[model samples]
Target chain A: MERMDLEALNNELLDAVLEKGSLSFVVNRLHQALNKGVLICDCLGRILIGSNSEIEYDIDAYIAKAIDHSEAYYYDQEICQLFFPIGWGKLIAIIIVREVKEEEIENILPVLETANLSLCFYFSKYNAIREVENKYKDLFIQDLLFNNILENEEILAKSKLWGWDFKKEYFVAVIEPDNFINIKTFAEELEYITKKLAKENDIEIITSVRSGTFIVISREKNNQKERVKEMIVEKISRANKYFSEKYDTTFSIGVGHTYLAYKEIYKSYQEAKTALAIARLIGETKFVKYFGTLGIFKLLYKQEAYLLKEYYYETLHKLIEFDKNNNGELLPTLDALISNNMDIKLTAEALFIHVNTLRYRIRKIEEILRIDLSKLENVVNLFVALKIKALLKLHYSDID
Target chain B: MGYGFLFNIDACIGCQACAAACAKKNDFFLGFRRVQKYELKYRGKNVVFYYSNSCNHCENPECLRRCPERLYFKRRDGIVIHKMGECRACLTCLKACPYQAPKFNHQIGKVSKCNLCVDETGDPLQPKCVKACPTFALQLVHEDYYQPMAQYYHLPIDTIGKSHITQPSIKIIIPPELQKNGEN
Candidate 1:
């Protein structure tokens, strides 16, 4: 292709930044005009602009192909540098079609320079604003946690749009993506959707990356909590429906009980996360409400919240005791117990132990608890008991 | 050993000469001031200050830590350089910095900072800040002695905790106040 009309490109870019208040639009326009069979992508790996040829722009397909090629094909394309452009450097993709003369390079210098300027302005402005916003968020959250000044309902109420009243309640919804999904994409999409939903409701959505999506829907009246929750569920269902149609993925949402003020927000966040976890276990493609999702824990534990606690304590405790009594044999025994459904004979074979010795240990366990191990109910009960025990221990211990 | 920086609030007339020189030398985007002169009041007195500031090449650099591309490098001599080839222009490092040091190019997602002209064609020892400062406010001093001199002068020391603890090998001198005793 002949050298791009540098003056025209420069004028176009300058006008774009000044008039449209954007640099990407102008750069994309330039790339579209070049018609050099070059594909131009923005910083985010999104195809901002490109010149058409036999090849079509499919970022997902490219990503999948890269995955198949084992990260070695990075050198084959000029656009590969888009993965990492050192501080403020533009990556130029040169197709080996022609040994473009130095004069041509010089000809496009003005356009390149102007494009460079516009890019710099946008980047600097974005970073400056983001820095300020993050700094303020950090300060605000830290203040809320350490200061205890938010505890004064009267003061907090005055700051609220509708005066602070303890009678006011907020429902917390925590959104979690499945393990197989891309975390950043999911988070960004969820944020966009939440913002859109908030805008429709005329409420500004305040979000932070403190784990996953922790959304607080403020309601002044007690009766409104359920109504807001229904709205949230309806919105999420619509979002999931759209996503399934577009990308073939399901979304799960966990909701928490209403809390009076911001002080109890952390607790609500935790509950929502737990609900999300339960929803994961009951996995399907649609959005599942987590508040009362699981009945398995109640049935398995006998006592509410005790099932998880007992399950961990018994399994771990048995391992520790077995390890202490027979120092060398505990690892194999623990492994056997976990893998073999705590069946004495099966566990013995898994551990390469004699059935008699496994039986002896079962006898020792019976002696410790005076409970019979021969029954299937006891074995099933013990397994769940051990799991719950472990969970309860982790409930207090898990940080972040 | 690495790149250095200098900022003299007192000597800065805020003519934007250093900034213009930087842009010219790097052929960088216009109106993007890598070396900015900030005029603000300190203790109610009109303090004419210039931050001939860009990258501090800090000891515990926040930009290095938060950068997703991990493109930044700290030379043994203390110059914090970035390999733009690896930059995705995510700007996480830019947000993490307390002193707005990283310059962003919006057309592309890349970021740039003052490299003290180490890799550029000009005199390697003189950064654009020092070259452009007509009042001699910014200077790229030798590390062996200049660092201590900078600390003693209270010249916007970059080698302090939680800010930029690395001792960049330069000293920025603010001229004594016109009516103050140290005036020349």
Candidate 2:
């Protein structure tokens, strides 16, 4: 009679994994199944999905120890905490069971094994589906960005395969993840969280990965540009803050202008890419950037190479030359100061130098350039020069 | 960080001291350093400034790059030196150079120009023109670091012509009189 009860419970947990497509749901199911506080963590032992239960042991060190064993299945009773290293071709997660006596772990072992089987099977099936979906998604994205063969009707027809409405106006955004320890896990986790956020925000988005970068497309029927922008920015900001706080993930998103026609959507995508490049150049990679509001940069980037070079020479070339000759740090110091709104203390902190050192650099810059940093005109000159210099580097990469 | 010349246009008083100093140092007919004066109508008043020009030893040295005979080569320090011994008087560099840097020497029947006053060991000696400027206008500086933008309130960029082509190693600090457009 108890064997039948276990079979039914395992069936129910499998059903939840299939239904919710979330590890947390399975985790919650296990929490009820064993009537214990349960949680799930990734390879780094950061809780990907869990309840508010305080862990009694250092999960990271334990996870490291388990990895050293190189075994598919690892179960060890350590005081009140029971760690189950679930694996099938990949170490998907490590399940931790809390508030359980060491003797009770023997009884819970079978149930944990059954749960592990269901999760492995679930991920294998999930990956299979995603692979097929990505195959079609990449084709559509390539067609939109490069092919330009498909008409508006064709685009709409293809978008419907993924349940996306390309008929409505849309904006394209490209995000590149940076400073990650593991790319595969980060991308997987980011996709899941982003999709969840999209659903919660009631925003229609089609996300696809291409060449290790995430491309998110949002469809909006609203005619007001600002409203659509505000809505999209709010959604993206929420996602940015969410990942940054939880995983310390740093990424930059470049958003394109709104386009009404489906054919025009590709233009926004192109603009978004340009904006992303500009963001990287300016060292402002932690925020969402829109093409329209890029100010003078929008106009400046398209200028002829000679003009860009001439402009750069006019402004910051002196400081650049000094740094090159003397191996000085004045140019970067000036850039940090300008980027940080001329806040000396913050600039010093960003450069990992003392405040007095930064001040000395600033004074040297003024002395060499014969311009007063305290004056707004001189600062603007320096600022514009820096922008032009960045553009010059992009335009004339072979100029060195 | 190649070598270049920095000229303070406002500080220059149309004095040919740089030209005279160059004449004495290099023994050239016209003195390699060329000083020109210009008048700008700003704030309903004519503001006069002197522009001293020379071989910029460009970042993209057209004289060296385009020379079929390869008579020109830029020093590691950014000075463009002309090898008169290898000169075929091709004049390809003369035409290719935007600043009219490669001058045709009728006396030698070959192309020639300022070599930045090389010493016995062929290293530039920071030409006497820079040292001769009485108003502390002309200066010898690193080519990459000393580039001064012409964008000011007056925007004197228009007067400097065809220079955008060569990307020369010259820095011109436009005077405050021309930079301030809101002056009375």
Candidate 3:
């Protein structure tokens, strides 16, 4: 074949492949252009598009043989097959040609090679386009979650175009992989797996990965919030198991409350974020933490940091200062007193100190602070102050 | 006094053929020309308006000013073109442009925008969008010809940054009813 003729053929093949048409239409065009009966099959050897219906060929066996040898296979003059693997062993599809003459083999081989190359190029292009589209979708979801999309009507219309049911009530759940090295790849894999799981379970969920966290905005059709919470917990638990077994990575899920309206969904996202922070702080054993269960911590967390710091200083500053100056054990004693429910014997046992020493520490704490530990109001105040200090410590230690 | 796009908002049917053609010509998977359809309740009637826009190639382009990498350059013919390989994808250009012309391509980790189909336009052909508009709503016209129509269309003489800071080169021809109702 002349160089000009080959170049023309190559251009024609690429034009056919790149044309904005269906895959079947492209394959049919290729068959007509090459003057050969063509059969296109997936990696599993299931015929997707074929020109010759009367021709009997064992395509599965041929594909297996071709893949094993990593080359094209020619079975007499009747049938020839080429395997087109896209992106490192991912066999996109196979092209099987029928009725080739001996003299036309050289010319036909280059055409088949061109067709295979074009298919690979087309598939990669298609995937690249799909990925870019998904990124735009991710941006939209991110904007919605962060309340950056303030125009509710515009968002509702855009969501309809994106095929998302904004009318459905939703709660946000954030999934984070423990000790992930490649967060971007892991997040993509997590989204894929979560999407597959959602399909299998017949759940309507919108998911996106942002800043290494996989976020799922799941629809809640049930009127009862408890049932919806139960359903989410069950789904997350199953997903956690699947991920742990398959990827060897444990995931922690933070679920927010279900809101009735789409406009209020950002509040759910905020709740989910707080749930994750509180779960990490309280040493939660379970992988899933719902915002509702966070209880008093949620209210306490909403207070201004300066107010909490002031309260902490006012209640425990003397004790802390005395401990710093004399290396006294009053703070530990107070903690033990609170944990043991103000039972002196139990507090002494828990602290691994003699009863006499415990009594002496308690006297010093009471005398230094000028507060009677026997009074229920003073005990309650000290207990609340200690809890606030612990919560503040957790807040400060966590890196946002 | 160079070439610019003239959008006949009255003639557009919101078909988005221009957007499709622009995407195909540029091989843009996403971004490029965006056809935004919005509805407004005016005079007790809901009216839908379509805005098909790409880069205006402004006479004083904000993208040229804010690009930290100096990726944008204006030709002698008043066409703003971005240097493809030099983009660091910092996204300052996206924020700077009031029209939001520069789009960040996540796949390539860079920003891309319409260059007025410079290669084809330099061949003395219309931009792809102008050529592909079935309703002939998009036209490539010289700035001298656009100024008169700009008055009729009530094209804003200023935008967010300052008074006529960017001096966008494009012209908009809004529908008569919309203009009377004072809808933007």
Positional deviation of residue A196's Cα in model 1 after best superposition, in angstroms: 4.7
**Model 2: which docking level applies?**
incorrect
Writing each residue's lDDT as its tens digit, candidate 2 over A29-124 gives: 788778998877766576767633576565666777777766443555554566787776568778878777767876787888778877876667
Worst lDDT 10-window in candidate 3 chain A? A391-400
Taking the tens digit of each residue's C-alpha lDDT, what string does model 2 give over B108-156? 7877777777753545576778878899898987644443232321343
TM-score of 1: 0.36
Screening candidate 2 with a backbone cut-off below 3 angstroms (N, C-alpha, C), the clashing residue pairs are A314-B148, A314-B149, A317-B145, A318-B145, A321-B145, B3-B77
Model 3 misplaced regions, further than 4 Å: A1-126, A148-153, A177-180, A222-226, A237-251, A277-287, A302-306, A313-383, A394-400, B1-184
lDDT over C-alpha atoms for residue B68 of model 1: 54
Most accurate candidate by TM-score: 2
DockQ for the candidates, in order:
0.01, 0.01, 0.01
For candidate 1, what is the interface RMSD?
Answer: 22.5
lDDT of 3 at A334: 94
Off by over 4 Å in 1: A1-8, A11-20, A23-58, A62-116, A138-148, A151-169, A175-190, A196-204, A211-254, A260-266, A273-400, B1-184
TM-score of chain B of each: 0.72, 0.83, 0.83
- The CAPRI classification for model 3 reads as incorrect
Candidate 3 docks with a DockQ of 0.01
